[model samples]
Target: MKPGKVKFPATKKGYDAATIKDVLPEGAAPFRRRLNQEVDITCIEEGFYGIICTPHDDMGMVMVVRSGDDHFPG
Candidate 1:
Protein backbone atom coordinates (compact mmCIF):
# COMPACT_ATOMS: atom_id res chain seq x y z
CA MET A 1 0.00 0.00 0.00
CA LYS A 2 1.17 3.54 -0.79
CA PRO A 3 1.12 6.55 1.51
CA GLY A 4 -1.75 8.04 -0.49
CA LYS A 5 -3.63 4.76 -0.24
CA VAL A 6 -4.53 5.18 3.42
CA LYS A 7 -5.12 8.50 5.13
CA PHE A 8 -6.17 8.44 8.80
CA PRO A 9 -8.27 10.97 10.63
CA ALA A 10 -6.91 14.19 12.06
CA THR A 11 -7.93 13.34 15.62
CA LYS A 12 -7.57 10.29 17.83
CA LYS A 13 -11.29 10.16 18.39
CA GLY A 14 -11.89 10.04 14.67
CA TYR A 15 -9.22 7.39 14.23
CA ASP A 16 -10.70 5.28 17.03
CA ALA A 17 -14.17 5.55 15.60
CA ALA A 18 -12.91 4.48 12.20
CA THR A 19 -11.38 1.24 13.44
CA ILE A 20 -12.86 0.22 16.79
CA LYS A 21 -16.24 -0.66 15.34
CA ASP A 22 -14.85 -2.67 12.47
CA VAL A 23 -15.34 -6.45 12.72
CA LEU A 24 -12.82 -8.46 10.77
CA PRO A 25 -12.64 -12.21 10.33
CA GLU A 26 -11.36 -14.38 13.15
CA GLY A 27 -7.57 -14.35 13.62
CA ALA A 28 -7.31 -10.99 11.94
CA ALA A 29 -5.41 -8.76 14.31
CA PRO A 30 -5.93 -5.00 14.43
CA PHE A 31 -3.41 -3.19 12.26
CA ARG A 32 -2.09 0.24 13.14
CA ARG A 33 1.01 2.04 11.90
CA ARG A 34 2.15 5.59 12.43
CA LEU A 35 3.15 7.40 9.29
CA ASN A 36 4.77 10.70 10.19
CA GLN A 37 2.25 12.65 12.30
CA GLU A 38 -0.68 10.62 11.02
CA VAL A 39 -1.70 7.06 11.79
CA ASP A 40 -3.18 5.32 8.82
CA ILE A 41 -4.90 1.94 8.75
CA THR A 42 -5.01 -0.81 6.17
CA CYS A 43 -8.27 -2.46 7.14
CA ILE A 44 -8.96 -4.20 3.88
CA GLU A 45 -8.90 -7.99 3.85
CA GLU A 46 -7.26 -10.09 1.21
CA GLY A 47 -9.03 -12.54 -1.13
CA PHE A 48 -11.98 -11.91 -3.40
CA TYR A 49 -14.11 -10.11 -0.86
CA GLY A 50 -12.93 -7.04 1.05
CA ILE A 51 -13.55 -3.32 1.71
CA ILE A 52 -12.40 0.10 0.55
CA CYS A 53 -13.07 3.49 2.12
CA THR A 54 -13.00 7.24 1.58
CA PRO A 55 -12.35 10.02 4.08
CA HIS A 56 -15.67 11.69 4.91
CA ASP A 57 -18.44 11.95 7.51
CA ASP A 58 -15.92 11.70 10.36
CA MET A 59 -15.63 8.03 9.47
CA GLY A 60 -12.16 8.60 8.03
CA MET A 61 -12.27 5.93 5.36
CA VAL A 62 -15.19 3.61 4.71
CA MET A 63 -15.19 1.14 1.81
CA VAL A 64 -16.42 -2.38 1.20
CA VAL A 65 -15.26 -5.04 -1.24
CA ARG A 66 -17.10 -8.33 -1.65
CA SER A 67 -15.85 -9.88 -4.87
CA GLY A 68 -12.74 -10.36 -6.98
CA ASP A 69 -14.16 -7.85 -9.40
CA ASP A 70 -14.64 -5.22 -6.73
CA HIS A 71 -12.61 -2.06 -7.26
CA PHE A 72 -10.94 0.40 -4.88
CA PRO A 73 -10.68 3.97 -6.10
CA GLY A 74 -7.60 6.07 -5.67
Candidate 2:
Protein backbone atom coordinates (compact mmCIF):
# COMPACT_ATOMS: atom_id res chain seq x y z
CA MET A 1 0.00 0.00 0.00
CA LYS A 2 1.07 3.57 -0.60
CA PRO A 3 0.98 6.46 1.86
CA GLY A 4 -2.75 7.14 1.39
CA LYS A 5 -4.31 4.40 -0.67
CA VAL A 6 -6.74 2.12 1.16
CA LYS A 7 -7.06 -1.60 0.47
CA PHE A 8 -10.43 -2.77 1.72
CA PRO A 9 -10.99 -6.35 2.68
CA ALA A 10 -13.23 -8.71 0.73
CA THR A 11 -15.69 -9.02 3.63
CA LYS A 12 -16.60 -5.35 4.00
CA LYS A 13 -20.26 -4.59 3.47
CA GLY A 14 -20.08 -0.84 3.09
CA TYR A 15 -17.92 1.63 1.21
CA ASP A 16 -19.67 4.99 1.00
CA ALA A 17 -18.35 7.21 3.74
CA ALA A 18 -20.80 9.98 2.94
CA THR A 19 -23.68 7.59 3.44
CA ILE A 20 -22.35 6.56 6.82
CA LYS A 21 -21.87 10.17 7.85
CA ASP A 22 -25.41 10.94 6.76
CA VAL A 23 -26.73 8.22 9.07
CA LEU A 24 -25.83 10.38 12.06
CA PRO A 25 -28.20 13.14 13.04
CA GLU A 26 -27.43 16.79 12.46
CA GLY A 27 -24.98 18.47 14.85
CA ALA A 28 -23.47 15.08 15.61
CA ALA A 29 -19.71 14.71 15.23
CA PRO A 30 -18.20 11.76 13.42
CA PHE A 31 -14.77 10.16 13.41
CA ARG A 32 -14.06 8.51 10.09
CA ARG A 33 -11.27 6.08 9.27
CA ARG A 34 -10.37 4.58 5.90
CA LEU A 35 -7.94 1.81 6.84
CA ASN A 36 -9.46 0.61 10.06
CA GLN A 37 -11.45 -2.58 9.72
CA GLU A 38 -12.12 -3.59 13.31
CA VAL A 39 -12.18 -0.44 15.40
CA ASP A 40 -13.13 0.08 19.02
CA ILE A 41 -14.02 3.61 19.98
CA THR A 42 -14.32 4.18 23.70
CA CYS A 43 -14.82 7.19 25.90
CA ILE A 44 -11.67 7.74 27.87
CA GLU A 45 -13.41 10.00 30.35
CA GLU A 46 -17.04 10.33 31.38
CA GLY A 47 -17.77 12.79 28.58
CA PHE A 48 -14.53 14.44 27.67
CA TYR A 49 -12.71 12.40 25.07
CA GLY A 50 -12.73 9.22 23.00
CA ILE A 51 -10.12 6.82 21.69
CA ILE A 52 -9.83 5.24 18.22
CA CYS A 53 -8.13 1.88 18.28
CA THR A 54 -5.01 1.63 16.11
CA PRO A 55 -3.80 -1.25 13.95
CA HIS A 56 -0.44 -1.33 15.64
CA ASP A 57 -0.09 -3.76 18.50
CA ASP A 58 2.67 -2.09 20.48
CA MET A 59 1.87 1.56 19.79
CA GLY A 60 -0.84 3.05 22.00
CA MET A 61 -3.94 4.69 20.62
CA VAL A 62 -4.68 8.28 21.52
CA MET A 63 -7.70 10.50 21.81
CA VAL A 64 -8.86 11.76 18.42
CA VAL A 65 -11.61 13.96 19.69
CA ARG A 66 -12.56 15.78 22.89
CA SER A 67 -15.94 17.22 23.70
CA GLY A 68 -17.76 18.64 26.70
CA ASP A 69 -21.18 18.89 25.12
CA ASP A 70 -23.64 16.53 23.45
CA HIS A 71 -22.09 16.85 20.02
CA PHE A 72 -19.79 13.89 20.50
CA PRO A 73 -20.76 10.29 21.08
CA GLY A 74 -20.86 8.87 24.58
Candidate 3:
Protein backbone atom coordinates (compact mmCIF):
# COMPACT_ATOMS: atom_id res chain seq x y z
CA MET A 1 0.00 0.00 0.00
CA LYS A 2 1.02 3.56 -0.53
CA PRO A 3 2.53 5.52 2.34
CA GLY A 4 -0.19 7.02 4.52
CA LYS A 5 -1.48 7.52 8.02
CA VAL A 6 -3.49 4.93 9.92
CA LYS A 7 -5.75 6.10 12.73
CA PHE A 8 -6.78 4.13 15.78
CA PRO A 9 -9.63 5.57 17.80
CA ALA A 10 -9.66 5.37 21.56
CA THR A 11 -12.56 4.01 23.55
CA LYS A 12 -14.56 5.82 26.19
CA LYS A 13 -12.60 4.24 29.03
CA GLY A 14 -9.36 5.15 27.26
CA TYR A 15 -7.67 1.78 27.52
CA ASP A 16 -6.23 1.74 24.04
CA ALA A 17 -2.76 2.85 25.03
CA ALA A 18 -0.55 1.58 22.22
CA THR A 19 3.12 1.52 21.35
CA ILE A 20 5.03 0.37 18.29
CA LYS A 21 8.03 -1.91 18.29
CA ASP A 22 11.33 -0.78 16.86
CA VAL A 23 10.83 -2.95 13.78
CA LEU A 24 8.27 -0.63 12.25
CA PRO A 25 9.12 1.93 9.59
CA GLU A 26 11.27 4.93 10.39
CA GLY A 27 8.47 7.48 10.43
CA ALA A 28 5.96 5.48 12.39
CA ALA A 29 4.44 7.65 15.10
CA PRO A 30 4.57 6.67 18.73
CA PHE A 31 1.14 5.55 19.93
CA ARG A 32 -0.62 6.69 23.09
CA ARG A 33 -4.06 6.07 24.50
CA ARG A 34 -6.24 9.07 25.26
CA LEU A 35 -9.90 9.19 26.08
CA ASN A 36 -11.96 9.82 22.96
CA GLN A 37 -8.90 10.63 20.95
CA GLU A 38 -7.43 8.97 17.90
CA VAL A 39 -3.86 7.83 17.34
CA ASP A 40 -2.36 8.27 13.93
CA ILE A 41 0.68 6.47 12.57
CA THR A 42 2.54 6.94 9.35
CA CYS A 43 4.33 3.88 8.03
CA ILE A 44 6.66 4.45 5.10
CA GLU A 45 7.97 0.97 4.58
CA GLU A 46 6.53 -2.27 3.27
CA GLY A 47 6.77 -4.90 5.94
CA PHE A 48 5.18 -6.23 9.09
CA TYR A 49 4.35 -3.81 11.88
CA GLY A 50 3.67 -4.79 15.46
CA ILE A 51 1.59 -2.80 17.93
CA ILE A 52 0.83 -3.45 21.54
CA CYS A 53 -1.08 -1.83 24.37
CA THR A 54 1.34 -1.20 27.19
CA PRO A 55 -1.22 -1.72 29.90
CA HIS A 56 -2.80 -4.78 28.35
CA ASP A 57 0.01 -6.29 26.36
CA ASP A 58 0.59 -9.04 28.85
CA MET A 59 -3.05 -9.97 28.43
CA GLY A 60 -2.50 -10.40 24.67
CA MET A 61 -3.71 -6.95 23.60
CA VAL A 62 -1.66 -6.70 20.46
CA MET A 63 -1.96 -6.46 16.68
CA VAL A 64 0.05 -6.87 13.53
CA VAL A 65 -0.25 -4.84 10.34
CA ARG A 66 1.08 -5.99 7.01
CA SER A 67 1.90 -3.43 4.38
CA GLY A 68 2.20 -4.10 0.63
CA ASP A 69 1.61 -7.44 -1.03
CA ASP A 70 1.43 -10.74 0.75
CA HIS A 71 4.30 -12.97 -0.24
CA PHE A 72 3.01 -16.25 1.12
CA PRO A 73 2.75 -19.02 -1.40
CA GLY A 74 -0.71 -20.18 -2.23
lDDT of 3 at 24: 63
Q: Write the per-residue lDDT of candidate 1 for residues 1-74, one digit (tens) a residue.
A: 22123455555432322333354433334543332245544434432222323234355454432322334445
Q: lDDT for model 2, on a 0 to 1 scale? A: 0.35
lDDT by candidate, in order shown: 0.38, 0.35, 0.66
Error of model 2, residue 56, in angstroms: 2.1
Could you give candidate 3's per-residue lDDT for residues 1-74 as a string of tens digits? 78756678775563665557584645655556564567777666766677776667679988877766644335
- Candidate 2 accuracy as TM-score: 0.26
Query: Which regions in candidate 1 have their CA more than 4 angstroms from the true location?
Result: 1-5, 11-15, 31-37, 47-74
Q: What is the lDDT of residue 73 in candidate 3?
A: 36
**Candidate 1, after superposition: displacement of residue 56 in Å?**
14
Candidate whose TM-score is highest: 3
Measured against the true structure, the TM-scores of the candidates, in listed sequence, are 0.29, 0.26, 0.65
After the best TM-score superposition of candidate 3, give how far the Cα of residue 44 lies from its true spot, in angstroms: 1.2
Q: What is the lDDT of residue 6 in candidate 1?
A: 49
Which runs of model 2 end up more than 4 angstroms from their true locations?
1-32, 36-46, 69-74
Report residue 66 deviation for candidate 3 (angstroms). Answer: 0.8
Off by over 4 Å in 3: 25-36, 70-74
Predicted candidate 2 versus true structure: per-residue lDDT over 31-68, tens digit per residue: 55455243433332323333333343235444334333
**Model 1 worst lDDT window (10 residues):** 46-55
RMSD of 3: 3.4
1 versus 2: better TM-score goes to: 1
